[model samples]
Target: MTDLIEPDALLFNPFMPGFFEDPYPQYKMLRDEDPVQNHPLGFWFVSRFDDVSALLKAGLSVEVGNLAPGVMMDQLDSLGIEDGKHGVLNMSMLDRDPPDHTRLRSLVTKVFTRRAVAALEPKIVALVDAVLDRMAEKGSFDLVEELAFPLPFAVISEMLGMPPTDHARIRELSGTLVRSLEVVTDEEVARAIVNADIELAAITRDLIEWKRANPGDDLLTALIAAEHEGQVLNGDELVAQVVLLYVAGHETTVNLIANGVNALLRNPDQLALLRERPDLAGNAVEEFLRYDSPVQQTRRITTAPYTLRDKEIPAGTFVLACLGSANRDERFFGADAGELRIDRPEARHQVSFGAGPHHCLGAALARLEGQVAVSRLVQRFPDLAFDGQLEWNGRINLRGPAKFPVRAT
Candidate 1:
């Protein structure tokens, strides 16, 4: 594909108006025009399905420390940020490369397997039904508030055996901290992210000590007990992992349920079809992920010179793998790639949870949660429809509605 944006013309400006509410058009432009976009900011973006898929499993470096002096790093430095200062964010497996990522992922992979998630199915079903029961009485409610957010939040809290606290505070902190994953260019936003990470880290530290003292049959307790190579996860590592869980555990599923339902409502034909064929629940979740991925883009810093489509990308180059675009690529998903088809066979091929080494550990859990939550809601509420205007979450990386009002008879 030929680059569309001329030199001095920015190929990707995430701040482009209306980009957040619906990034698909922009993503399509990138995929069709500059499949391997070299941004003026000194980084690259791979939007085509084949390239994005290959890049994820290419064994490239994910560690920011491996990045050469570039625009992103310079921006961070200008924000008065010191290296290794964001301990809670920096130490997680999400940012690690190779051996460290492997070690950290190994510690928790067993708990998120298909069979493990199956064991938790009853709990998920019960949770979904319970929320639906409450919504049943109201007849109309904000789906995001009443179900989407709380279900995953409560599930993760229960899984970790966390004590009751201010749920709103945690939600607020979690939302703020997610901006760390985006391209933060504002000074105030950067400071807010740094502050939020610190506060959340403190809360996690206290939670860890409490869990250590009062261990039980839960993920946190299990992490406390887990050992690798005769060495247990230390203080900093423990905090990072727990925080990562708290965020990833709920964030991904919340988007799935909310975005999935929103998609169904928008495409009434598909929604009616889903209502008729509830068996498509599992496949429906995959379509939801592909139609509108929760986590849109993932980054990797090249540890060595890499060549793609005849262009040689040098070592230490930062690359943003556009997962959302790849999921919608016409070359891979056929001519109607833009449309939401619930039964699409290639839906599961979407790279929403990503692929390769850092693919989301909580994917199976998220899928199960989404399948149950979305399926039961449609089944329970025969007249499910939009109640009011939808509000986008204003995030470029994680796309979902902030407020999803719906009414059902």
Candidate 2:
């Protein structure tokens, strides 16, 4: 569709229908024609692999406070996203710069270490089986509803030792809250996000208070007890971290399983390969991450003048490091970068979980979940196939299928 139009106006427009469903074509154009795009909106788009990698680890600031007075702030201001709104979005370590980021991340990093994640293998296997068993009962089902969505939600809830509550309501609130991370031109959506954040924060506070009364051997309890230099996470900090963990813990992995299954089914050979060799489950998850990243882009504010190739992004500018594009860069991943090869040697190097200081803390856990979920899925139902039309979730940042109808038998 963009083959005839000017690339500058429409190229990175996630609203475009074709680009929303399949963004690779536009991504390829950006990489080929303009690897570093200086958007008119006071932001820079870095599409190349090396440049993206550099930008991520270039000591850039994730905090919006570092952004110089610019159109970006005006954009946010226009949407009514002021200081007090979007509470968890602002407070989480994902939005913090160093010292604070280091401190906040360290509080829960050990829980997601390789050893910790590995120890959850048996539990993960059981959980996956539990969901798959339900799927088996219904010969055909929506993959998202049946297996992909519920598994991670259960795991995260269990890890946090959350009391049994209304799952549907929380999922609704979370789905709305995450929209804050994506492109929001609609004031309605912006307000909805703010409202969701408020509601979710209230729910989280109540949960934290409940945990305070009845402590347990779980992450929420640990966060409640965590201290650094005699300073514990105060009320707001505790709420922010717990909310971040709850949202990030399940949402991305939901996309991972759904997207991984979508990719494998689309590539019959890869699905067959996974079925033939179950041992490839772990590595296959990495390849799946590379093939179609659940999280497409991560943003950072330039702290200093950042030069990439020949382009120098000025300090305090918003730079969108396109991880999805970088993962498929031909220059780095070879000529078949667009193709899915489960055994691809460089698959593990994909920046789907990102790199540097703000790299995803739940990478190990997500990998384990994806490995188990995807591997057991195809193995259990050898004839697994897409049963109906697929619908892309209209989210630019966390892009995946919203409706994934599939045959389990």
Candidate 3:
């Protein structure tokens, strides 16, 4: 590979701060000209919807953690932190391959079924109303803080049997963990690792111990008691599962709600349509996920040499599936690909939640949260408008607003 072209031109440096401010342009260029661009760093960038979808469905790969540990190790090294033995948070069923993945997913699938998620709807609605009530009194607010952040926190917290008082503490810790996702200088990385380690260890240990002793009627307790006759989650496995659920369950939903709201704010006509027809809220959330997904990109590695779209990707090459870009590819989505339209017939087909076996476990929970949060917010504040310049979180893989100030009438 005689260094085909400038790495910068083919693969955008997502670690850079400027990329976060605007990745769409870079993504558009890649999708148009280099759908399978080879990067100098020995990875293939897949930006088209069909190509990315095919790769995901192909399933001839390992999870990003095992395959491209450097992706994470480099992140950890940059932060001056010694990585722990990779555990469940990094090894959920979603992260594992075939047999193991199948077993692990089967064990946890019962807990997140549509019926189970539906049971939480009433509670979710209550949480949304309570948050909106407070925000209504203020007349203006940051939706991320006042509504988007806490709604999912409450829903997931209760599901895991955590107390409401711990919501603030857990939310703070989750924020710190998410910040660690941004590729930053060693100093910042060190701070993030220390913060994440302390908070995650303390919270996971405390909750696991409590669930062990008290034996509550919550997901944590159930996971603790779950077994396959002789097989069960070991101490570390149990802890990792809790940590995974805590982080994935809430962090992504936070982005979904925030990103969804930001999408509506940016598209006033769409916002008006949603305001007038709350029935479209569900479909609209799907479109929002496609337009600005919470998880922007995911990595995969080839098990052996493979040819894709006329390019040969060797073993050990990291494949970056730019989901955010793929969702807007004109070939799959047509001319209005980038536009936010609830009426679009193909909006539901977006790969925002991903495809294949690793599709988000909490997709149902996220959808419920998004629908309720957006519908109620729009209904309560029909005149909601952006009140200040939006500040985006500088994270490569997560697309969301850091601060979305809005005025509600």
Q: Model 2: clashing residue pairs?
A: none
The TM-score between candidate 1 and the true structure equals 0.93
Judge candidate 3 against the unseen true structure and give its global Cα lDDT, from 0 to 1.
0.76
**166-190 in candidate 1: lDDT tens per residue?**
7888889989888877766666776
Q: What is the C-alpha lDDT of each candidate?
A: 0.84, 0.83, 0.76
Candidate 3 regions off by >4 Å?
A: 1-8, 15-18, 66-89, 164-169, 176-191, 194-199, 228-230
Per-model TM-score on C-alpha atoms: 0.93, 0.93, 0.90
State the displacement of the C-alpha of residue 107, model 3, in Å, after optimal TM-score superposition: 1.2
Query: Ten residues in a row with the worst lDDT in model 3?
Result: 66-75
Task: Quote the RMSD, in angstroms, for model 2.
Answer: 3.1
Report the poorest 10 consecutive residues by lDDT, candidate 1: 66-75
Candidate 3 global TM-score: 0.90
lDDT of 3 by residue, 182-261 (tens): 33334555465555645676678777777788777788777766753437554465565677778878788888899888
Which RMSD values do the candidates have, in order?
3.3, 3.1, 3.5
